[model samples]
Target: MTYLLEYSDYGSAGLLIPAGLVLIHLCALLSAFHSLQHVRTSQAAVAWVVGLVTLPYLALPLYWVFARNRFEGYREAIRDIGKEHDQSVTSIRRELFSEPCNQPRTFQSPLAQVATVMGTPVSQGNKYRLLIDGIAFFDTMLWQIQSAKRYVYASFYIIRDDQIGKRFADALIERANAGVTVRLLYDEVGCIRLSNRYLRRLTEAGVDVHSFNTRQGWVNRFQVNFRNHRKMIVVDGRVSIVGGLNVGDEYLGAIPSMSPWRDTSVQIEGSLTRKVQAVFAGDYYWAARADLPEADWQRKTDCGTTDSNDPSLQEEPSGLGAVCTTGPADERPRTSMMFSAAIGAAKERLWISTPYLVPDDAMIVALAMAKARGVDVRLLIPSVADLWAVYLAGFYYERKLAEIGVPVFRFTNGMLHQKCVLVDDSLTLIGSTNFDNRSLHLNFEVMVAIEDRAFICEVEKMLDRDFANAKRSNGSNRPLRPWFARAGTALARLFSPVL
Candidate 1:
């Protein structure tokens, strides 16, 4: 009553003033629904609500106005939402990052036959193998590209035109000239530093190329933030490759930029490669000019390999390496759910490697809980992060995780960009999705989950190398700063959700 009276006395405002606040609140509620209705599941919708309620009263909006308003990804969308007159920061900004955009055909449908021949696992016949470091991974990729007979589909968040990229491009062009259908997709923002002429050369060489959601205009700028971060390759519908590796010398450790880029990737055979192709084809159609036929092609060979006596192969498990894509197009991308499942299923240890470290609160809590359960949870991050604010946020979590007994390691080499999470000695997750709020809820991303023990073992081997080189962040290594740094960090934290 005192507050009401004070408001009334200050400006002689009438009862109608409260109605205005009520109206604004109502509008916020409605806008939140419209923003999140298209998401895949109820949990995502709930998250939208939670963010709307929690952020508007905080300083996040003011922080976002300065930080993300100028980013190429959010400019157009921000403008559109602002024009709505009642849009909140959360409603206007949060973007879902999941794999639903590349919806696959049913497992047992007629499409399964063609998809199976293309390396998509069908029913009970998937096989997966992991390649740990850039050396082995690069060699394997080169061998496969050289052996291609039909078509090649490749996509990556970053495709540098350095030694490794040039090598891959050369092999791809060589195969394209040999009558193989070659298509390549790269993220515009991820490749922003490279010259436009760089990709034009690929086009000139007859390799069909497209960029994911890239455009330059006043109205289409929202698409820029929705990057395709997946690194994948499907060869001739019989084999597929995916994980954290990108086409760069850093990834191969051939360039001196970083001491060694530690990463994980997998080779899959059986029917699952078709699913990868299906997702890639969706991206190709949406971003490129060509329209390939989606007709169900019968499998030319059985995806299952029952014989263990082949000279080039040995006995393995009977499970087909299923391709799982997570992105925003689904009712819920459920990438977080997939991670949760992997973390929960961990037996011995959980090893993670990521360039970025700003995860949502739930993810942090999940990690803490895992540590509490006696799971050996380790995180490998860059000692010198590209962005200082993001680096501080990483430091913020260091104290908490360390207290919980989760060991954190900082790579002594240059910046690490690969994002990977491995559990026990087998299960692994590799793709474009980061453990940050932006990648979890806003960006369009994809990842592949593998359960093969051999693949996990390879990932462990590579992780061991990274673990050795990483320097521990003792809570007291860097001197504590003055008030302004803490204030700046606080401000950054306000907009961390969008950052």
Candidate 2:
């Protein structure tokens, strides 16, 4: 009777607000149920449920964008064209494994589990050079782009329209005009500021360029957060550069705010380069929806004169390595598992450097457990934060790990952007994977795992120099974060699932 009386008093026109509220709550209930069933982490599930149940209006849109753990569109697209990709992947694996991985007498490859997860094989006879800081950022990479004989392929997360970008554009335009096939794939979200004039200049020169649009077609309209963060370039499917440095003035340490911009990338060649090329092909296909017919799969990379007399150009044939490409499209959490495996495999010392350090609980436990086993585990994060939320959250994790005897160092020499890992004397990895939830779960990432003693030493010495410039902190003497930063830590935890 009261409901009827109120409806009559308000008339049909006033029912809109109440009707909308009922529908919103109903939708919230449905989303809450979905959260309970689909969310992988129990804590995240509970948080989502509580938020959706109490505040549906605000939480609904966020849930729609961030709650999805799987990249359904990427998987669906893969299913549409997976046959060719799978066959190629299988063929590559057989070719890689035909040459035995030269394992040490006692040490087994710790990356075996990672290889299984990525469905790729570790191959021998590969050569790699660790490119530290600005040494190889443009000097070597640009030279290779200029030296392209057949084709040039470049993919970056972010490309500025500044001086370095123009130089890079000039190289590709020159190559394309010379009848050398040139293609570029850049992340749309990362390169949102990239002007169309820059792209037009390349296209006018016959360069094929496309953005890796996160939201493509109807199936992917809701996936706004997934990003292609892989930074790699392959020339003629022979030589490749894969790692943390993207094409920008900041990457070259020219930007005053981000100067001395500490970063690392590697120029690798040999059979392993093919795997890197294939990974780019997959992303390029996703972006352009076409086969890269020009990619030379049959030709093996000759690398740098392997016989060069010049000291800077002389690089030895590396032993064994594999390229692990991972993303939200994967069935399992491959990036997190890969990092965990590396942590678990460290028998002597484990050192890692990344800009952000907000990892999940499971990864935290893995790091602490490694320390318990007497492994000299150390973490290097930036003293100057590039992303404030991620940096503040690192303080929380740093204290947590320190309580369990894992010390973290804050790199004081400008900003530390290198994503590197050193495991024992023969194992090391470099690429664009950060030790954070974003890289572990949300973003598309690629890492090169090398089991070459010579290359590993190069990485170790580089990190040693970084440690020398960083400040170490353990819970014992480290000061607590600011009271306001507690809010940032909470914010980090709340968004880490989707961030």
Candidate 3:
């Protein structure tokens, strides 16, 4: 009423001021209603509603950037691509699965064999092992890229324009020049600084390169909240390398601050590699809107392993592995479900390593439940701080988990950038997912769940070494941070749902 009186007492400009305020308030109310409908969790929805209703002036812009719970324009179509001789390519993005991808096979447009990442068929004789560090990961990845025969599909979150990036770009260019079909996908926000020269060289060499267009234009640039954070490279649809190492010199310990980068990637060779390529095909369709040149998807069940009764050779667990991909487009929060299900299935021990550990209430409860079941649950995070807000929020979570008797080990050897989870003695997960709301609820992410005892032993040995070098903090006897840092944590946690 006071605002109305002020507007009425003044001239036309004052009247417009009140109208603008009303418009802003109306937009906030609408966004609040959207939050109620779209936000995955009740806790996140209520937080947005309270802030939006109370502080529309400050909250509206932030809401525009971060509060969109779904990636609106992403598509799941697997086009029936032509052969390698096709001269041109065209693509169109569509929202095919308007709900949770429960019936993923129904998405088979004209390519029925092109599988979704929901649940790949388990097969035998697939050999999967870990690449322990950046050196091993890159050495194998680059060699495969250089030796591509039919096609190469590479997707990553970040591709820096440095020595590592040049070596990667040169490999793709060289392969393209040699008549190998090459497709490259990088996150738009992650490679926002990627120069035109770098991309131009690839295009000129006849390589199909596209950014995962999470953002449309500079006018709405902050819509970078959604990202395609998948790191995968498939050569001839036979070999796939999936994990955390990005195309950057820092990943190789070139930077003094982040020396000795610690990460892990898995290379699977056999029919299962086709599933990883399918994930790339779906993402490529969304970004490039064209069909990928067809490659061999023939199922071979007995290739990578020999049928032998010797004790040394008979210890394999049939190489059971399944792949799952998740993102904002799905109606249900699949990433959270994926993580919770893995946590629930751990009977003996569960070891998780992530650069970030900002879990939600449900995740806290999941950890508590795991501890109650006597599962040896441990979390490994980076001792160093990359993003202050996320790093600080981790302390708050560490304290909360400590209350439930779970301990966190901080890696001191280098930055712990691996998103890996080893469960008991048979299952392991590796890919480009962080344990935060953004990665679990918002980003387009991928992880291959391997359930082979042989592969699990490999992952266990790697994590054993990682844990051996880490510093353990129970968070019960001592403060994780000083009073000022603790105060910062309170503020940091306020943004965890969006972080």
Candidate 4:
């Protein structure tokens, strides 16, 4: 044949071409295998069909690399067994009591209007308490956990086995041991350093613990990016806590590393608690055993009733009341949309505090437009951030904001992990929704849109306290070695999407 004659004309042609092809094919196969392993099972199935139809030669190599190479033999066997023995179960007759959420009288609660505008009925009549600071938030939350009589359900992005976390775990265990159902869920990646032995102790003590997006075998390596970043605590179906604060020494400012962990959370009582329960339940389905039993966790509680002028509804009126939560699993959570509405509705001033501020395109546009409309926009960030990559990525926005009359300040004392937004001395949003792309689109996060003047004023006071110590940045405040720094900053900004 002509091709056979051409191959014969070259020296070592038989050896080189096939060898090179095999090597390149192996490399591509392995890379594709590893990438596919990181994806979900459903995604892997689709990828399998594509590879089989278009590149049949790659099918076996891809499958072997993805399914066999990454996991230990023993863990693989255990995970296979678990896939069959998942023991969660729920009865169809289980009474899941939940009332509709409070209606947004104004634009303060952004999502409240979405259903209404679509001709759907948005429930109204829930009560809310706009809580501030870690101590006030956690103390109130722990009290409710201790008081939980029927069942306790909670989850967080981060959970340390420290004092605050220990107290919470102990309370849940106590209730669980007393025949009150207790279930805890946390993100595996976020709490990677957290000891399973410690968690095992809680389990032995009676608490049911689960990790979100976690697997025991090779597939575990692939699911590291997706996390349940939402912080929530639903107690006895009557009360719930959701907000920015997580279970850590840093969150409590009790650890030496974080001397003053400034944060916010909200405790909800009334119709809103049921909505939070739904959010928690949906997450439980994804993270825990899908067959887990659902009981009628809802109960009647006299504290913090949904009365606009109730004396107990007043801040800390011998109780706690508020709401904060969002997640990608939910339908149209729209964290960014809620934030935009809050910013747009600002009548007097807008103040924001966050550890990271890598705003996405929409958030950047919203802030700029708010400034154009004459809102006094301000931002507070840590002077020395734990994550410099994100810090630098967010720095360029300071210059851009200053050009448009929006002031940005960096705190010098400690890491400012508090995620806060205060608007018009009337509306405030406090929770885990950072001004970043991950929070807006990827991570499960929570925030409360409060229309209470008292709470907003308190948030403004906190901002004022932070501003006094922060180093203000303006057009003329560029550092001395400006060009090199600017170049480095620009490079960082280019990769900001993933930071």
Candidate 5:
């Protein structure tokens, strides 16, 4: 009778523990169901479902933290804000349409199609100078900021609270104190380590500062995957700078170990500057929920024109460019479509350079098709990556492309971080968007597509130099690894949907 009572008590206690576990699992299943409806990719949805149903204890929290697909409330907030500024957006659109590009007939159709997809038209009479490294980029950027007479709108993905960052902050503060309209936007996740003191200094100096908060509302409290990866600076509605370089001492090669940081940026003046400003305006409104002053749309008649004797106008009037801003807020996946379009349009040659090369199925197919059609395809990626998982994941895709006859080059010299695409000798795509899943579907990105033969040649020459320094590989060059190392890479590839 005693043994029977003891056994019954143990059984009841065990039941209580499993009953609680069952309830927790049931809740996890409910969350997994929610994920199935919102996850961006089918593969990701299935993965979450299986993991949640089988290993709910571990997968549930990860799903909540990192598996958010769409940016909840951001689109709605953008819509509401757009409705409030419908007049301004419409007016800007009208102005963009009024100033048509004088591009060659062969380039006009494709450019127009891209413009339609991006909702920003190609503008002509724009002067462009390619800044090869951080030194040139920051020097020119600081000069532009100092010369700001009306307003300065600046945005960056990573703004370190270091020496270089303080210089940038001081310049902006100086302009702000001088009564120029100055607004600064930084990504909260990218600047996660930024000190409060740094931002406080800017705010105290009368600079309008805001973070691109990915998790801003109740619905988005756990959604932290989306990021604003764009780096742009627009000064006085006349000069605009955009590219891969962020504000940091490392970017300037101040750190002896990470010296010789390879990056690219373009400085633009003329009609295209206004379009860049318009891009800034949208982001500003999204971050601050306040409307920026209407931009001055008056075109500089002598915009890209410079006297032959004048060295300052050396980069004048060389190309026509359009700004493409894309994010999850769009009803359609415009960035993916844009990449496909550029790839499909290439007939002669296609060259690409990006730090990350974990492309999606669509991109892989596009590249394969391009090769099938007899187009020369070349890809440049970092030989030594800063992110270990991303580096390993890149090898998986690199092997796939190499098996298909596409030559992949691993940059030998420092870390190559520039994002650029060259199609034939006409189209150049340069900006923050990388050839990866995260950039294509999740992050908010910007790219400037320029159609100009002269500029394209310069970019080609620059890339040729990069290719010369890089080691060409077709997977055979990759060193043999142990089973565990290979397995790690395969696992990283599996998570490419989120990476």
Candidate 6:
């Protein structure tokens, strides 16, 4: 009787263990269903549903880490803020640039679609200078900050607490101490390694500093996928800088292994600078919950009038440009639309350079169509990767694209960090946006579209030099990839919706 009783207890305990596991798996399936309803893409939703049903223990944790897409409360906050000051802001901006011929001619056909998507009208009477590398870019930027007379607004995705970071901070501090009304914004996730001491020093010197806090509300406590990836600096409402360079020693090419980091930036002066400043103002309000007082929000009485024969106006045609800013807060996917339109408009050639090349279905289709129609499509990606998983995943796409006659090249000189596109020989798009899902659907990004012939020629020459040094791939040259690496890439691709 005692032996039978002990056997009964063992059986009951074993049954309980199975029951608990069943319950846990049931919960995971329910979460997966929720994801299917909320995920941005059908591919991601189906992947999550299958993974959760088959491998709950592994998929559940990853889903929680990177599956969330909607930036909770951010869209509502932006709407509310705009409602509070929409008329005043719009009227003030109009009055500030109230001059004849300030409005650029509406772009025809496909480019017009991009203008509508961006919601910022193309402006005339703006000048631009392309900065090729980090050293020249930073030198010009620092000098402009030092020369600020009224105010300065600067934002970067990553601001490390290193040598270059200190130099940037010191420059801002000096301007702030001299009563320049300096404001700085950095991404909390991108600058995760930044020390509190570094920020405290800036605050002590009277420079207002804040992080682009995507985790500000309770509902967003676990939402770490969204990022502010824009790099912009506007000084005195007259000069602005925008591009891919971030604040760090790596950007300066100080690390020997990754030395000669290739990048691009642009400095702009004229009416378009105000538009950039306006974009900064919106982001600043989201970060600090306060308006930048020195921003030129009122009308100017001395706005320049159009004079075609004027020496100043005839000297150059670099003033034809538009600013496009997009993020998760937008009602639609503006960044993706912008890229698609640019690709569709390409008549002769489309050259692109980015560190990452993980394209979604829409972008892939766009590129394929461009190639089918005889658009000379070429892509430049880094031969050596800083992230192993990303590197492996890119191989899949590179092979697929090359099969369609889209020539892809790997930069053997060093890391190609420039996010730029040359559409034919008439337009150039440059900014912090990358050709990946993260930039397309989950980050705050800014891009400038320029249609100046002279500027495009200059950018073309620069890209030609880069292409001469890169190695062209025929798509059949991939080395033997291990089974484990192949598996890792397949898994990594499952998370590309948020990567």
- What's each prediction's TM-score? 0.69, 0.89, 0.85, 0.71, 0.88, 0.87
Scanning candidate 2 in windows of ten residues, the lowest lDDT window is 96-105
Report the CA-based lDDT of candidate 5 relative to the real structure: 0.82
Q: List ranges where model 3 is wrong by over 4 Å.
A: 1-15, 76-120, 216-222, 302-317
The residue ranges of model 6 lying beyond 4 angstroms of the native Cα positions read 1-30, 54-58, 82-113, 298-318, 477-488
Best by lDDT: 5
Roughly what TM-score does model 5 have, to 2 decimal places?
A: 0.88
**Between candidates 1 and 2, which one is better according to lDDT?**
2
Superposed model 1: Cα runs more than 4 Å off: 1-127, 214-221, 254-257, 294-320, 403-405, 474-491
Off by over 4 Å in 5: 1-23, 91-110, 297-318, 475-484
Residues 1-499, candidate 5: write the lDDT tens digits. 9999999999999999999899889989998898889887787888899999999999988999888756667656646777887766655554333333332324344455566555566666777888888899989999999999989999999999998899999999999999998999999999999999999999999999999987777878887888999999998888899999999988887766556778898888877888777777777777888777546766443322224465544554456778888887767888888888788888899999999988988899989999999999999988766778888898788789987889899888788889999988778888999999889888888888887777788899999999998997665856566878788889999888878
lDDT of 3 by residue, 1-499 (tens): 9998877678788778999999999999999998899776788789889999999999888888888777765543332342332321221111111123332345322111111323334434578878988889989999999988989999998998899899999999999989899999999888889998999988999989999886654544666688889999999978999898899998999977778899989999876687777678778867876766465545355212234553544555466566667888776677877788778777789899999989988888988999999999999999887788999998888888889988999999878899998878767889999998789887888887776676788888889999999988665568746899989999999889778
lDDT of prediction 3 = 0.78
How do the residues 1-499 of candidate 2 rate in per-residue lDDT, one tens digit apiece? 9999888878866788899889999999999999999887888889899999988999998888888777766655544555656665444434333323332223366755455445556655778888888757688888999899999999999999999999999999999988999999999889999999999998999999999887898777888888899999899877999999888888878877767899999998787888888788777767876667677677443222123454533445446787888898888888888888889888889999989988888898999889989999999999887888787778778878878888899988898899999888868889999998889888999999998887888888899999999998554654666767777777776566555
Q: How do the residues 401-440 of candidate 1 rate in per-residue lDDT, one tens digit apiece?
A: 6666777788886667667887776566676667776676
lDDT of 4 by residue, 1-499 (tens): 9987787778577789898878766765665656465433454556664674457566655444333212222223324334653331111111121133433345444333332222122322445565566788878888888898888888888888888878878788788888988888888878888988779988998887888764444645443334577888888777777777888777766765556666667776664566566556655655553533554533333222245576544544322223444444334436666677667766668789888878866777878888888888889987765677787777787777776677788887666787888767555666677887667655667665554445556667778888898887654655643687778788888656445
lDDT, ranked from best to worst: 5, 2, 6, 3, 4, 1
Question: What is the Å distance of residue 408 in model 2 from its true position?
Answer: 0.2
Candidate 5: residue 226 lDDT (0-100): 88
Ranking by TM-score: 2, 5, 6, 3, 4, 1
Top model by TM-score, which number?
2
